[model samples]
Target: MAPEQGTGSRSGCGGKGRGRGKHLPGACWDTLWGDHSPPHFPSGQVVKLELLEQVQAQLRDVLDKAMEEAAQSYLQPHRKDPPTQHPSPPHSSGLLEVEHFRTFYHIFIAMLCVFILSTVAVDVINQGSLDLDFDLFIFAFGCLPTVLATWLVMFLYTLLVPYKALQLWAGSYHTVRFPRLFTAILLEALLACHAAVLGYYPIYTVIQHQLPAASRFIVILKQVSFLMKSHSFLLEAVPGIIHAKPPDGEMKLPALSTYLYFLFSPATDQLPSPRTPYVRWKYVAQNFAKFLGCLFYSYFILECLCIPVFTNMSKQPFSIKTLVLSIFNATLPGTFLLLLSFFAFLQCWLNAFAEMLRFADRTFYKDWWNSTSFATYYRTWNVVVHDWLCYYVYQDLFWLFRGRSRVAAMLSVFIMSAIVHEYVITLCFGFFYPVNCSPSLPSSEVSAGIQVCLYCQEWYAQIHCPLEQKTFWGLVTPRSWSCRS
Candidate 1:
């Protein structure tokens, strides 16, 4: 017999001679040879067994190659390609043509003109001469230097410290055992330090020094915004550094210029590099003009509506009638303020920066005014911040739970957002006024119910009112009335 046949016989006969009558079972021999061989053929069995091994090896190679391809695709979806840009809805003038926006602009300009005429008329009636002063505007922006200095300090710390710490931790991660735990502890400590300096100190200064409302607003808003930005930067960048395998076998930190751009970019999340189309100076100039226009619009709204009505209501005794009237009055200005804020920051301000930087993604605010649902409103209102919260907070929490508890993850996001909102308001106002009730409540169901009731009221009113009446109301009426209760 040949060597291979002899080896197969020994294997089938339990490593002994067949004279011992200790041969392998007939079923095992049949399985190895039955498909192509005669019933008594041992040589065929060896050939079939070798063929099966070869086929198994080929399958293993194919599976490994498939897995590797899948992983590569997932990890590098963009793969050095330019980011896809979602253009804003069609606009003849590049601004969203929402209903009543132009009408409101005209009305505000007229109101501002009326304000100047009225002030001059009153001066002529009393002092007999026009004495125009901008003391109110100056007062509204008091302590400007202090606010800027505070912001500059916060900006520097955020720019330098957290990023450096992240780099340090990421550099050490690969060589060290228990790197995840060590890096986590390092991150927590850095956050603790940042919180003490930027978070607590600024708030304490606002309260302790009794800063003016405008000054306090600048400080507190900057504090909160910078904190969020820094957190997002670390959350986004550090992971890339940690997992990256460079050809040189050394991790490289992201460029300072890229990070600085991210800090100033209208976007809340960090990108490796955002797309920059060729800049049009005209577009940039137009957006800046609109930003200034919105600022003036907001100022007039506050001067004409909020101050006069809210001030008078404060001095009067509290009664049901007065309370009801105050709410009705507050609604107009409140809604105006809301709209102004939305347009000014999310649209005009962000777009100006985006255009100047040649950043192509300009779909910042969607047509949120047309949203029939509160869920849609939240998503469409201010996408920059919403994107950050969804990615860094909500998605991370969902991932931590292994995607088993979606409701829990969503609730956690709402709770976190509410807390931040309340914290910013309380710190800015230096008071314990929980103006937002939804945030205070633990149940997301309650929050959703509130939104639903508000939506229903608006829907009902629109259904009942005639087209002309609806148009009038849409221009003048405030949605804040629905939330008064």
Candidate 2:
């Protein structure tokens, strides 16, 4: 909420930290002076704005130290503790604490600085002007009015609809004449409304407006995240309300602050780590510093290497050898971008927020690069999201069938993750090609069914509704590229 650092994806606008979020592309800037002065009391006196900034910075620092993350673990496979009757969220650091890894990072930072100097020298000599080209950033994050409007619409729906509905249900379920029937009807109606507004509204907005690259991502990802958070909140609250009926005045609702915090937290489920206390300024510094390195690394690699190779390939005659060489040339940039993206968004930036938010579990990534098998790689690649999926989807489905159908549970998890990813990709890119998103699960029928459904959807998109307004299905394919992809 402070003016210095950007809040989470909840409020995308008013970020003073320009290069902050991966999804939020810093489309809007915060005001020079905040609306409130920290030193002023509620009295009507209008205070000077000079000391306001310094006081806010100090207050923010103190709060960052005092704030602690939620105490819940969504995934602890080996834990022996018995499950509680109440259905609360039962889950789930830093960049580098290891000595050698920190040293490697330090060396990497030195090399990045050298590249930055080289770029400066090149710009000075070649352009004869040092003015930066923020236009590309502007273009990527273009359509600001639409982006903010779309965000406001989604945030308001998520904030009000689910929370209030659940609160109302909690209070009235005991008083209703036919509680079970009433509960079922209320739940069905709520779900139908969620499907309409959260699901279709963003799709309509994106298709109608044809939002720019970053704007589309912000809208799409924010919608997806809000859905997850709302689901988690309700999932945790519903069972407790059902099984444990107390006196009217003794009834408890999830605190509004906790729900809001969970919505803004980096991960889907609540994050809990008790060992670390206040986050040091250096740790926060390390996060942003590494983030800047990623930006510089990406910029230099694209401008110096990837762009040239692609341009040269385009001009040259097409051939098998050229294709092979082009692919070979692309391998470096492709690999670099993938790795840098993992470090930049997940490790650096997300952890920066975790630190500031007093979240202690810093296991953003694992030794995924060293993974020997596909299963291992998939599990380790993004531990936070995978853990969340395992806890919520896999565990629930596994128990839903009394643990007899592990395959069914795993397939459900895969299908659910694919659906969300595919939906985001579908609208953002304005095309549908999810051949690889739905992978084979050996049961064959599940994957086959999903693939068939996707095939039908793709054809529907290509025929009835052309998102790009023009399409060549059989002859030529519409090209869809995204920075997020």
TM agreement with the true structure for every prediction: 0.66, 0.67
User: What's the lDDT for residue 287 in model 1?
Assistant: 70
- Full-model lDDT, candidate 2: 0.65
lDDT of 1 by residue, 299-372 (tens): 66666655565544444433567555655555555565566667677777777787677676666766676766
Clashing pairs in 1: none
Residue-level lDDT of model 2, residues 1-485, one tens digit each, is: 44435553224344353222222222222332244333423332223322443565577677666553221333435546544332211122434656877887787678667767777788899999674674546666789899889889888888889988998899889888999998899899888988888888888888788887568988998888788788777887887788765774466788887777677667777545543345556767988987877876877766665655554444443456754565556555555566677888888888777767766665666777676655676687788789888877788899999989999888888788778776776666556576556334412333333343333334333443334444465323422211111
Query: What local lDDT does model 2 show for residue 163?
Result: 86
Stretches of model 2 off by over 4 angstroms after superposition:
1-92, 121-131, 248-250, 270-276, 279-282, 311-323, 433-485
The local lDDT score (0 to 100) that residue 298 gets in candidate 2 is: 73
Instruction: Give the CA lDDT, 0 to 100, for residue 73 in model 1.
Output: 90
Worst 10 residues of 1 by lDDT: 15-24
Tell me the spans in candidate 1 whose CA falls farther than 4 Å from its real position: 1-93, 96-111, 245-250, 272-274, 438-485
Q: Rate the local accuracy (lDDT) of all candidates.
A: 0.64, 0.65
How much does candidate 2 score in TM-score?
0.67
